[model samples]
Target: MNNLATPGMLTAVWISLIVYMGVILYFVVRGARLTTNMADYATGTFQFSPAAIGLSLAAGMTSAATFIINPGFIAYYGISAFLSMAVFLPIGAIISLIVFSKRFRKIGSAVNAKTIAQWVGIRYNSASFRLYMAFLSILHLTFIVLIAVGLTQVLSRALNVDALPALSGIVIFTFGYMMFGGANSLVYTNMIQALLKVVVAVVLLFSGYQLFTNADAGFFQQLQQIDPKLTAAFNTDSPLYRDFFEVVICQLIVGVAIVCQPHIITRSLLLKDDKGMNRFLWVAVILLILFFTVVFTGLYARVLFPDLMVAGKPLPLDAVMSAYVTTYFSPVVSLFLVVGLLASGVATLESLIQSISTTITTDIIAAFAPNVIGKQQLFVNRLVIAVMAAVTIAMSYQQLVNPDLSVGILAQNGVYASFSAAFVPLLFGMFLKNVPVQAAFSASVAAVVAHFGIYYGRLTPYMETGTRNPGIAAALAILISLLVGAVVLVLYRQTKKEVAV
Candidate 1:
């Protein structure tokens, strides 16, 4: 909570951030040269290597949550958070990515779909559904706000500035370049960010090496010395990691459906051909596993800040990582860590801006006013990004000032609702043949209702709690969607059979 960054560190961060902006601008200019139309902007005109695309996927999937936010949860609740976030969540997400990527890409390519909404509409032959999903895609703005807030937390601490100016600068700069870069520049930038994150992840993970060496006991024992609850398999004291259901079952379900988001699932479409699929998957999975483990740094932070305080001030859940980096590391090392932290947030933030803006421009706006977007689709897309920037600035400011535990909760509520709605449609469309559009549509609607209905309405005991878990609501929503979809599919088949008879 205190400004731990020295003047020297602030100078270093400013220089590094400026140089970083220049590098990003160079890529944006290059990518913009190739992007004459919205289509080129959406999917890129280049044939990227599987390794590059894989790194992009890894970077996009990790986001600020992996490097910056979720670790706060780990610091608070302990290993139970680690198992839920790093272990079980990745297992389910990787499996889902492997299963869905190829099939989704196949259909997406066949239909020439650029965005998730476009893919859904073309897959089911429904213009209205595309518009509906495009509107739903606006939920991703919550995620963008999450990344913005995370980046602001890091930059504000590193530069010794207030959060408002830091957030505004981040949104303007990132969204400005993203309007031009799209997929073309996003992959290259993400690949670089992923590599930087790998270095920082290693540095952060091993920063606590002294803790392991100084104590006679093992790591878990050290944690036990701090608090037995920190070493426990389940942290009953924590709201989110209270039990087996919340820690494991709910996370696994959410992980599987999490890939249904546009920036994540559409990464497969960036591949030029099917032959690259294996290499892409291999690179992404390996990097993701490494990136996920970065949450272990939270354990180290917990060791350092036993009471989660600095200078007699309590650390917010979101500020734990920032406090650790500034307080524990040397100025030069903290400089590197700060830049890497920025990269981790920027990587996925870029993807979200590109994918969401494209969806709004090509899917939603074009649906309503096709003639308005006739030849100046690129201009319209830029305008949409500008509007998104304003919205992000407004929403992120609110979260920075007053959050529900952390911005992660607000993000999960909106993002979980989105992908929960998307999961049924994508799953039924991918694996099931002759599935009625009505079934998928009905299931998507049910998912939206179920997720928000549970969260805000507090329909269940889990929701009734003060600190509600979005994963519980999301998992229930997914299950309800599956049930509703299956029932509808069966009824449709029965009606068809009766008609044939």
Candidate 2:
């Protein structure tokens, strides 16, 4: 599509973005000043209020997926995608957060674990397992690519620039600042981002108010006018929202396990103690619910562009919101909205970069490579973040140029696989005592195998279509992992009982 954004508007956006980056850099430099070593970088030494940590947690958990990518799915598939993403998935994740957070926090705090990999090593007493998880954490780079692509689509459209320059700017600015800020700067920036997201979410959700109030035809009727299935709870025409299996059940399972991600779960570790748990959770959950509803804006985008076309050309799904924003809003309001969108993308991007790099540096590099002292370790982490940026930029550029529908597919595959593997280890470690580490390890192995096997082998009905849903593979992996853990637990208990007798 020809540049829908005018030159004057593009210039305004560029100026505002430059100002935004400057403010962000100031914070990162300040945080870097306070950061003495790798430990401080991984987990902040700053005293954070429950509200700050909670908001940061929400921002980390809700990323480009909520604000950008998933909304595209909603626009394409209608209410079925909404139900799966904004409703059922939120419920499962919130429930998991509530149940898992307190227990996990107590253990994490007690051991003073810096990374999730370290938590696993400490919990199961296995250095090799920690190393394995550190390697698996590389999967999060797919998520980073999603954010990068999402941001690139938004900014390139807004600035009327090529995708490569926009992608480079996003990766370098976000990831470069991240190498300095770590958790200390991240929480501060994320709090601001979460607040911006709250405003953006409200604006986006209500942007369709005119359609809702139409006397001749309401929103549902309007959607029905376009496609009969669009108004339905399930849209069989869509690849990702075909049935209950794909829509409701699978999403719920994925939701519950999604909390096991390093950036998501490790947020609790930022808390000073257990006392902040309830307040932290309340703030995070309430804000997250609001953030999740932003996907409803996709429905509005469909109502605006029923044919998914702009300027007589078909709009890419990833660019739908960008088109919607530029088409609807005044240049000034569009600027703020663009900032919020950037916040949504970069907040989680910052967290993922920080967490993944820290994991690699502390858990993998330190464990294997020659003894690295405090200052050296800090330097190593910065180096790791730089390397991660290079890799992410390379992958992100490919997805930007050529994607399989949306980048969500690639992200969900890698991210879901990592968390699926982590679920058993996290569950058994937090809740159960004296459990054989082998059971958790076996379950982890089985979960990864099951997820990849089903996905690649097309073992299930969900994979029969041209575009496969990763949720199906993830759900099955989680279930199989649970079963494997249960079997091992029972056998271990039986042997102990026999020995006692």
Q: lDDT by residue for model 1 over 411-457, one digit each (tens)?
A: 99999999999999999999999888999999999999999999989
Clashes of each: 0, 0
Question: Which parts of model 2 are misplaced by more than 4 Å?
Answer: 2-4
Q: lDDT per prediction?
A: 0.92, 0.89
Residue 236 lDDT in candidate 2: 80
TM-score of 1: 0.98
- Provide the lDDT at 208 for model 1: 91
lDDT of 2 by residue, 1-501 (tens): 533377777788878888888888888888999998888898888999999999999998899888988888888889999999999999999999988888888999899898889999999998899999988999999999999999988888788889999899988888778877888899999988888899998888888899889999989988889899987888888888889888899999999999998898988988987888999999999999999989999999998899989889988888888888878777788888988999999999998998999898998899877599688988898889889889988998898878998899999999999999999999999989998888998999999999999999998777876888899999999999999998998999999999999
Q: How far does residue 76 in candidate 2 sit from its true spot (Å)?
A: 0.3
In candidate 2, clashing pairs total 0
**CA RMSD of all predictions:** 1.1, 1.2
